[model samples]
Target chain A: MDEIIRTENLSKQYGELLAVSDMSLNVRKGEIYGFLGLNGAGKTTTIRMLLGMIRPTSGSAFIDGKRVFADNHELWKIIGSLVEIPYSYPNLTVYENLEIILRLRFISDKGSINRVIDKLKLSSYRNIKARNLSLGNAQRLGLAKALIHNPEILILDEPTNGLDPAGIYEIRELLKVMAEKLGVTIFISSHILGEISRFATRIGIIHEGRLIQEVDTSQLDKLCRKRLLIDARDKQAVYSSLMQSGYSLSETKDGRFELLDEKAVRNPEVIATLMVHAGCPPTLLHVEEEDLESYFLRTIGIKEDLR
Target chain B: MKNIKATLLPEFVKLRRSGIFWITIIIFIIIPLMMGLMMFVAKNPAIAAKLGLVGTKSSLFGRNDWPGFMGLLLQSLASIGYIGFGFVTSWVFGREFSDRTLKDILALPVTRSSIVISKFIVIVIWCILLILVLFSTGLLMGWLLDIPGLSVQLFLRFSEKYFITSFLTILICTPVAFFACYGRGIIAPIGFLIISLVMAQFAGLIGLGPYFPWAIPGVYTAPAGTEGMQLFLSSYVILALTCILGFAGTIAWWRYADHY
Candidate 1:
């Protein structure tokens, strides 16, 4: 893959607390890399390090094969970012706020501001002061600022934070188009696992200030634990019959037998036949696939029941 | 240079929209009008007697003429300029942290040094404009009062001293900018300003005013031969060093510190 953003063992320690540790990841060009983590799991810290806002205690980060540094003015020209909950100069209008970014980015085309406002659907709120803007519109303004310069790489931390469902979907589709059509590489951080799995080309889960697991979105289904669930009118007979057939089973909280065996999960009909012959017809039999949320929690060593 | 210019445009835009900016300008304008009222009271004993407290306060102006009025203006600028200019610097730099807008500019194509310099430039311009407003208003008030002992030479001399006092006072605001960045908000820097003002007073009482950056401007405002208020060549040097250090410190903080 053509790497656009890369971190090699990037670590940041604040006093005694390790905010981010040994984080190594790569985001390819035109790929939306989702950085998923629970709150306080080093998502923002890692993003800060990647943006060269916070220096790492050890190792380093790179953009387009160049080392990241706070004073590297040229490096930031091609990057746009929103670290956390985005904030703007509250006294400034949406158009004025975007204009600030456009000027700072040294963008010659003044029309870029209007283009971004229209892109984010913020035309109606163009003259409204940022403090008077709704949280959702404020978030849209933040996104508009990030997209104003048409950066090649975007680093966003919870970009959909204060947005409504429709706003979130709009931003998601916009990012998708930016990645697919404009070839803009994005490294987005969020705690929303299910939401990330929807558009992210690949996802990395961080836990306890460490990158715990990294997998492509397509591989998530194969990695997520799937099981065969069977419940019958007579649970005792079904249990005995499964045990006698040398099949391993575990009981769910609702008194259903769960089979982790690949054959049983792949062919639920076989188990149905066995249950029927045992004179205990299965009232419910289906394969249950763990969702991305559960998989994310499990990968982070947090049990759903405990949570 | 180009980066600083690019950053300055946004800084000016922000300053133009800020409520505090307008409030500071209004306060600066009002201060001279109030001074003129005091001078007017001093010029008339009849009204001064009727208003006892106001009379006694205006009576402190022994000469009550053009030179005296100009000297009073310089003294007030030395003190008020310190606080007012410090407030402007605090708001300019500290609002970024208070409003949580620092991160937006941190990773921009414009250099952090450029941003810091632009903020300082805006602050200097703001403070100078306030001083100009106060001076112009004070001059108009003095002309209306028609106090005696007015001369072309006295006006030029006093104007030069007034501007020098204003310049010295404005130079000290750099340290306030440092505190704004180091303390990460307006309150800490304003607190720092208050403490410095108090310390400047104490330094003057102890006959060490010339050595302190905050007091040097006030010491300069005193009469040339005033005892214990005489400023040496080293006083200017110390003030300049303090200004440089403060400017360097703020820039370094922006360029190197972990904003998070």
Candidate 2:
């Protein structure tokens, strides 16, 4: 794959503390790359350096074969970014804000503005002040603003942080479209495990300013941790059957049964059959595997208790 | 060129949105009205002498009343206009940084210097508009006070003096503009303005106030006579040098300063 963005030993230090250290990353064109990290894990810091918003103490990064710091104006032209939340002049109408950016970029084609507005479904709110928008609408506006010029590369940090469920789904779908149709390589960093997993083709897990692991979507299922759920008609029968199977279930607070198991069960289907044999009619059975969230926690050495 | 236009157009929009643009216009018109009211009240002899508006009235006022009045008023309020300029510059740039709008702007194709220059031009344009408002107010006041036919010469004289004085103000104010860019919080520009005000006042109290940046505003001060024209010309050259040096220093600092 052709690389769109590459960083070599990129590092940033604030006085005595190293915020980002000796990190190298490669993002190929036409790939939806997920940068997963917990809060305060240096993800924002790294993105800031890439966008030339901060100077790295050492090392270098490249965007479209141009050094990030050396050629910021040209590099930024190719990249659209949302660092935290999108902010504009709160008093200015949506159209005003978009027009300012469009004018600054010297984009005279009115079609570009209309296309992005239509794509993000923001035409109705075009005259509304940015301050009056709800969080979901604001997130959509942020995404639209970032996508307005139809940038070839996008670097978004917590893009859907304050969005509702529908907003989240809309963004996920939008990312998929950009990656598939427009061939716009996206670097999205998020804390939500399922959200990134749904759209990202490749995932980079960062913990404490270090790139702990980089895994493809196909390999994620193998890194699963154990979380089992049992749904049976008779609770007593299921409990007895689990005891007989030598699975020690923990005391649960809710109206459901839960068990914490470090030991791997070879097959979850075995437990389902045991419930039937023990006279509990099986309704639903599910095995929750380790996802991006679990993997991030485990890699960062954050205990399940702390989480 | 293209970059300056791109950067400047948005600043006009920003000024329009902030309401300061119009307020400055209103002040330019309204402040001179106070002077007109003073002239009207001078017609009442009983109150005129107490206010000292009667005896001091001279044939000089009859010779060039409108231009002289407008020049005095504009020069008086020049500090106020620049204070407003400082306030606007600080708010405009500071809000972008605090609200994270700078992040959005930097993501565009424009250069950083253009961003700074665009804002500077916007303030200068606002100053120009305010100067026009001052001239118009002066004309209106003169017409109401029953001064004989107002000619274009009056406007030219008023404009030229204000123009020269404004250039001096801009020179003394270069650092204030730079502070607006460099300062982070809401208080930063205000703090710098206060410091300049104090420094200028203190420098004027002493005899050696020429080298100080704040003394540029007082550069044209001369006893009214043939000496005034000579003083204005020499001082204009010195004021031009001050502006050139201050602007050069600001550009140099901007080239090296880390905007982020």
Candidate 3:
């Protein structure tokens, strides 16, 4: 496996607080790894450690088979990142800000600046000072800086901050193209599961400074609990029939009959036929699978009722 | 060589974009003009008395001539240049924290030590330009007023002393840079500057100026004939050591301290 990014039991601690503990993850070539968490969930800390901005208390982080450390300056040449709210020199114009990054990255291709400006749709605000930019433009400028060098891997923390719905969609498409078409690996973090679920090849959920779960996006549906939600004109009759039939039905708080059995969920049409034969033809028959949000909360043990 | 240019260009851009740069130039320009005006007023005692408190203070220039004018410039450079240079250092390093942009540079291909050293170079260049500006402007004022007893040798001697005094004052700026990074803002380093200025004054009064790092620059500006104001050989050693420690501390903090 071409693991572009890997962490080995990485941990970080301040005086009395364990900010991150034993976080180990791997991102292979061209994989969009979504790091999901709530506030104070150690997502930013882990990113910083990956970028070599903060020292890991134990274990190590590697990018392209190189250990991350202060002296490993060459390692950053192929890595792009935005750890948090991106701030630039407020007094400098957007173009000037990007120019600084280009120079620092030792990128000799001057045309990359203009290409990235057009890529992020920041051409209109190119000449304006960063302080004068709207929050969304400032965010685009940050992304532009990160993508200007066309690095092999990107580690972004809330990359869509301060963006409108359209801006978010555009960036999402841009990141998708960069990953699928250009073979760039991305490790993105966000509190919104629906957003990451759209593009992340795999997802990792963190809570209280621990990696609670990691699952491929393709398997998210299997991981999410599914149930047959059944309603009837004669609700009592339906409940009686389902119980006598050994269906093991349960009544939710809203007075709806629910079947959690895999056979019942998988064969909803069979349940429908049984209801028709029992003379309690269901008024409402549908299968409701957990959404990504509920699944995430349930996975993190924050919302137990949903599971 | 390449890294220095890359880091310095952006720092210079930041310096040029700030309103503070123009303000420093204005202050440097006014320092010499204000001294010239004092000499002009002191020469005419009638105007001096009519101006009341201003006139009485102008009398402190003594002869209202080249020697007196150069004396005033030398003393003010040591006193004011210390504050000015310290402010420049604080603004350069501390603004990164205040603006919250330090993270942008932390993981760059450029070494943190190179960035820190680049900032020090900019500070030195800025401080030196101000000193040269003040010196030239004072010379113009001296010639315009045609203060008496001006000679080539005397001018050279005073020029060398003024340059040396500026150099000494700038040496202590390294500590201000350390405080700027360690304290993570302008307030701490500026506060350190103000406190050091006061402590230097107190040390000067107690005849311990040679021993105090902050007071050594001011003592260097003492008049050539003044008794007991001379800098000791050990004073140069102490200043050099303080500078080394300050620069080393700043580089270490940038290299190892947890930015978050």
Candidate 4:
């Protein structure tokens, strides 16, 4: 019951291509588990398996301690999902599209459609046909459909694909509140690491159809490499001074001296004092931590420069 | 039953909003009107001669009376129904793939089996409405033309054969549903439909119409005692089996296949 969603060695193969390979992961109750991967990195495939939209080549996925399968209608009762680019019956109005989901989800309250529309800020476009709505509004309609039932678990795949910055922020805040206030378990996949890192309690990075890393969002700072960058009026003198002092250093492309030594990064004041004493006071002496994007790329065995 | 209703309601809503629904209605009505016009021309040889090729083609009905008109309508149902009903079936099932909405319904609280069954039910109901439109319009047109030889017995017999022929034609649409899922779009099922229509013609020409599901409905429309057009009990059995297989195959694909 604590583990709202679990996948055990779940994989999918399409002839010679392995779409998902031995992917084992879990999302606990009220936790926003952000699944991160590059495009074609099996994020959607894994999500499809998790939702029982596609069968796994091996292993299984479970929700609320029940196995996932097509006929397990009961299992889908507590789950609301938006997979990939969400689409609806093009000719149906946004209200009608959500109504279809409301009925199909077996909700007795007819007012649920209006409530979700209002919540997703789709009230203005309620009468607009799905095909006629702009990409941002279409995405909102998709989210409204997923949220119409107010299920306990939500599986969203790139749910913010076509949203404007404001729209993205609104959706992110809504998801955060859902997870925090209502205890809704969210399993979200996105290629946007910085965005996911903001609200996700835990993050799993998938690459080449395999999950390569899983770390708490809070621990990302520790996991990501940090360095002290120093630029001075007298660069050669400062470089010599740092090397003579036995501090490991490297040169950045912008001609700044980088010190990866923990002592230099943790106690930048010490490096500053050294620079002052060496007759080459630092113009820029700042400790810079590797961002989530860089860390993700590095974890996937790809150089940041290459990316 | 609740789940079926839940799934069926959406199917009807989608169908109602689609332009194709009204387009099919107009096509059905126009077909009977065209048939009526042809009957009127055949009834007047002087006008028929002045009309040229269309006049000569109207003679294919064999007579200008009510019986000839009813017979042509039944035959038209067999062939046109295959295309019309098949189009409805293709749109019902194939639009899910073409519109990229299949994934939205795959893991819903309502079972996939219920969704598939509801689609078929919608197709059946829609196709039946088209049949009624064709039959009613044909009746109106015949009355307006006053081609003569109208009798109560003949009307009842035509009604019976027309409905049976419509049912047989609709039954074969299940395979089109299967192809829609298998091919994942409308084009494949329609391709399958056209090819089957051609094959049905060849099957009837080769005296094997009774054994072919698509040809059986056409054979049923032929006048009784017509050589090589007679239907056996086995013909009904063959059509029923093909229908059951297609229905089961569609449900199986919905339940077991890995939908992307």
lDDT by residue (tens digit), candidate 4, B195-237: 9999999999999999999999999999989999999999999
- Alpha carbon lDDT of each predicted model: 0.92, 0.73, 0.91, 0.92
Clashing pairs in 3: none
In Å, residue B241's CA in model 1 sits off its true spot by 0.9
Candidate 2 lDDT score at position B134: 72
Where in model 1 is the C-alpha error above 4 Å? A304-307
**How does the DockQ of candidate 2 come out?**
0.45
lDDT per residue as tens, model 1, B53-162: 99999999778999889988988898888999999999999999999999999898889999999998999999989999999999999999998899999999998899
lDDT of 4 by residue, A1-307 (tens): 7998999999899999998999999889999999999999999999888888888999999999999987888888888899988998899999889888888988889899889998999989989899999988889988888888898999999999999999999999999999999999999999989999998999999999999999999999898898888899998999899899999888888888888889898999999999999999999988888887888888898865311
Give TM per candidate.
0.98, 0.82, 0.96, 0.96
Q: Which one wins by lDDT: 1 or 2? A: 1
Model 3 TM-score on a 0 to 1 scale: 0.96
i-RMS for every candidate: 0.7, 2.3, 0.9, 0.7
Alpha-carbon RMSD to native, per candidate: 1.5, 5.4, 1.8, 1.8
Better of 3 and 4 by DockQ: 4
Give the DockQ (2 decimals) of all models: 0.89, 0.45, 0.73, 0.89
**Candidate 1: clashing pairs of residues:** none
Residues A1-307 of candidate 1 have per-residue lDDT tens digits of 4998999999999999999899899989999999999999999999898888888999999999999999888998888888888899999999899989999998889899989999999999999999999989999999988888889999999999999999999999999999999999999999989998899999999998999888999998899888898899898899999999988988888777899999999999999999999999999998988887888888888865211
Model 2 per-residue lDDT tens digits across residues B63-93: 3355455655665655665566566656655
True contacts kept of each: 0.89, 0.58, 0.62, 0.94
Native A-B contact fraction in model 1: 0.89
